[model samples]
Target: MGELDTFTDALDYPVYVVTTAAGERMAGCLVGFASQCSMDPPRFMVWLSKANRTYRVARDASHLAVHTLRDDQRDTAELFGGRTGDEIDKFEHIGWRWPTAAGAATAPVLDDVSAWFLGRVEGRVDGGDHVGFLLSPVAESPAGPVRPPLLLLSDVVDLSPGHPA
Candidate 1:
């Protein structure tokens, strides 16, 4: 392995489930490559693989709902990460809903998650096989009284992704 690979090997980043919609189409996927990229302007970036169906929908999506996962939510992770959207309807298996507020975009918010936020897509950056979606937080779900420990990469290292990254 290279030096960069060795460096990243020691890190365990938090896992997130990002959901978005365009017209009648909606998609969500397990994401490990995302972070808060800006502080002053408050921007978050999520990297989606070009091969995933979510990427196709996100291309025309105006907003995305990013959900935080907990250690106990491994089953949810498996559903999103292990099954491809091309083969099945993931939403039918999970509890989710469209934003009810007036003039809200059709981003699907996941239920029973640790926390979540709605972000308007600001821009897109082509990063080889992955495209980074720059987001500015427009809304957020109310925080639960207690915050649980987050699910990490190390916890799902053995999972086979639904689609090749």
Candidate 2:
């Protein structure tokens, strides 16, 4: 492992599925690099690989939805993480709906997730091989029953990415 891996390898971060739609096209991908960057303005950032289809569509999209998966949702993670949107319509197999919330309509909100937030893409930063999307939360799912264990990086470590990063 490399020097950075030495530290990151010891930490397990939650994985998220980010979805975006540009015109008639829609895309979603499993993302490992994301975090809340601010509190006062309620900002979050999600980094997308430049080579991924989601990034391509997101370039024109005004909003995106971030979904938190449960520990038992390995199959959902595999579908989004292991397959390319270039070849398949990943949303067809998954349950999702266009947000009824006014500004959050640009992306599909995934069903049955532990939690999710629809954010407007306020800015994009070119971050080497990936681009960081600064998001301002516009809508979010209401709190449900007791939360379950979240899907984490360690849980999906064996998954081969659908697209080269």
Which clashing pairs does model 2 show?
none
Lowest lDDT block of 10, candidate 2: 98-107
Candidate 2 ranges with C-alpha deviation above 4 Å: none
Residue-pair clashes per candidate, as listed? 0, 0
C-alpha RMSD by candidate, in order:
1.3, 1.1
Q: Tell me the spans in candidate 1 whose CA falls farther than 4 Å from its real position.
A: none
lDDT of 2: 0.94
Query: Residue 157 lDDT in model 2?
Result: 95
Largest lDDT belongs to which candidate? 2
TM-score of model number 2: 0.97
Per-residue lDDT of candidate 1, residues 1-165 (tens digit)? 665898899999999999999998999999999999999899999999999999999999999889999889999999988888999999999999776651565699998799888889999999989999999998788878898999999999899999998
Task: Provide the lDDT at 84 for model 2.
Answer: 97
